[model samples]
Target: MMELFFKDFIMLWSTIDPVGTLALFTGLTARLSKSQKRKVALKATTYAFVILLSALVLGQIILKAMSIQLISLQLAGGIILFLFGLQMIFSDPEEGTGSREPGHQLAVFPLAVPSIASPGAIMAVIVLTDNNMKTFTQQAMTAGAMTSVLLITCGLMLIADRIFRVIGHNGSAIIIRVMGMILAALSVELVMTALGVQRWMS
Candidate 1:
């Protein structure tokens, strides 16, 4: 059980990538006040948790019923993430993103979706909790690991402002653009990997 928990922990941590999420959060919420930042962080983590837990519980059934392949999600998420990355890179530094972005909407989007409950995270949870392949006990352990990682993600985000302060206002824009470039490349890689997997499977 300990081994299973550790294995799933490593997998979940990599897929969730709390540090990456925190970096993205810092970028997106750069203009927000401390309270607003906290709210966004908490909301994003909660939404991500719900999304991922659902994927763990009913993902296979939903996929089968809808005749949806995981590749579709990968493609969609990659495209959306790539578009957002472009926005981040080119967005005006003088404009106030936090004021324009609704609390819930911002929390639900780029933050909760691709950054936290990412295509990779969703796929990882579903695969780890597969009803056909994993026993109930193993699935439970995986769930525990998932919860642990998410909690850590939430904690990191709660302190994201301090992290942002280190970068300072002047550097925030630069970091956002740099992270955006990296994010764009990552999204492209995700799409390519999904296509590669499809070809390999075929």
Candidate 2:
């Protein structure tokens, strides 16, 4: 249904945070040549896609093996995401300067791991596609939505240089802080939902 699709899309978008990824990508690859930036963008997006898709497919099995409950996972994920959002809001811009170093695998390090295919994103996909609750077709829909968001992320990265020029570093920093606030609010909502606060209110 349209409602389900919209929910999936919004959840994935918030977790993926493509604009945040773009800001980081611009910062990390700022010194690279245009061609090198393109390569980094492609590789980073590819790595992130693989990581997220794998989590979507295998997360439930792994959680079951560990005897983890969905509500527990959601609460834990919300806490992690909130902390990460806080870090993004307060992190120093110079912290990522080392990523510009020669021979550093920037794509896999900050870009792929916590930037794009972030812990929040991994948790979100698992929560979205809980095997006990969602049908296979519904899970497939969530996967599709995730893929769409990643594709958009890649597109943004490819155009990151131009966007950076338009926005400048200060603009990028402002955007990152704003996204962090949004992410923090969303994480709080996730926690509240996990606690059944909405159901109680209803």
Candidate 3:
């Protein structure tokens, strides 16, 4: 049981990828003020928590009703992440401030969905909490592990916000472009893995 708990923690940590999410958060919230960035981080984390918890509890049923496979979700999410990555890469880091939506809306988008509570994270929770495979206690332990990871993710985002606060716009611009490339590569990996093309190619 203890070993399983440890495994779950590591699994969730990889799927959640708090550092990756932190990069996305920093890049997305670059235009906002310090206080706004804080609120966005908190809100994105809260939203991710709610989303992952819901997936743990009810995702299987919902997916079944929609006749959707986890791989399909992964494919779709990968496409979206790739597009967002391209946007982050090409668009001016300091542009879009005046015409764009508010910070709270950003908390719901690429930040919350594919960034923090990613498709991999969602699939992981659902699989970990499968009604047939796991007992209630085991599922509960998995949930606890996921929660711990999310807390860590949130902490990292907060710390990143502080770092960016010091570094200012120029530093933020460079990292955002770098993270965009990373995100694009990540999305491609997600797609290939979902398609089971990895073993075929390499």
Candidate 4:
């Protein structure tokens, strides 16, 4: 049981990538006041938690109804994640700030979606808690691990001001680009695994 918990925790942490989220949060909320940044952080974390929790609970049912195989979902998720990573790598910082409204839009979009909950994150939870493979207790444990990660993410966001101060805008941008490249590579691996390319080669 402890081993399972540890495995789930590591998988959740990697998929969620709290550090990467912090970098993106710092960049996105660079212009907002402390109080406003707090609100955005809380909202973004709440939204991400709700999204992932829902996926954990209802995802398998929906997939069964839709007749979607796990491999198919993985492939689709990898494509989405790869595109999002590309955007993160190439997007102009000024464009992110100028295009979106400060408060609500910032919380809901790039921050909450691809940045926090993320395609990879969503797929991960679904796969981790697969009804056929894991017992209810195991799934519940996975949920707990996911919630812990999100809470930590929120905590980091709340301190994003300090992080930004330490790293500065340029530093944060560089880290975000680096993370994006890593994400793109991970997505490609996910795609390959889903297609059984690795298995075939082995």
Q: Quick one: ranking by TM-score, best first?
A: 3, 1, 4, 2
Better of 1 and 2 by TM-score: 1
Off by over 4 Å in 1: 93-102, 197-202
Alpha carbon lDDT at 150, candidate 1: 93
lDDT (10s digit) by residue, model 1, range 96-173: 454555465669988899889999899999988889899998999999999999999999989887877788776778
TM-score of each: 0.91, 0.68, 0.91, 0.80
State each model's CA lDDT, in order: 0.86, 0.79, 0.86, 0.84
lDDT of 3 by residue, 65-173 (tens): 9999979989998999899889878988656567454587778887888888999999999999999889999999999999999999888877775777676778778
Task: Kindly give the stretch of ten consecutive residues in candidate 1 with the minimal lDDT sum.
Answer: 95-104
68-171 in candidate 4: lDDT tens per residue? Answer: 87678668767876887798799885664544445777798767886788777888899999888899999999998999899999999998888777877678
Residues 74-190 of candidate 2 have per-residue lDDT tens digits of: 687678668867876898744755545441477886678667887678888998988889999899899889888999999999987887678766776776677677668867887
Worst 10 residues of 3 by lDDT: 93-102
For model 1, name the residue pairs that clash: none
User: In model 4, which range of ten residues has the least summed lDDT?
Assistant: 93-102
Residue 145 CA displacement from its true place in model 1, Å: 0.5
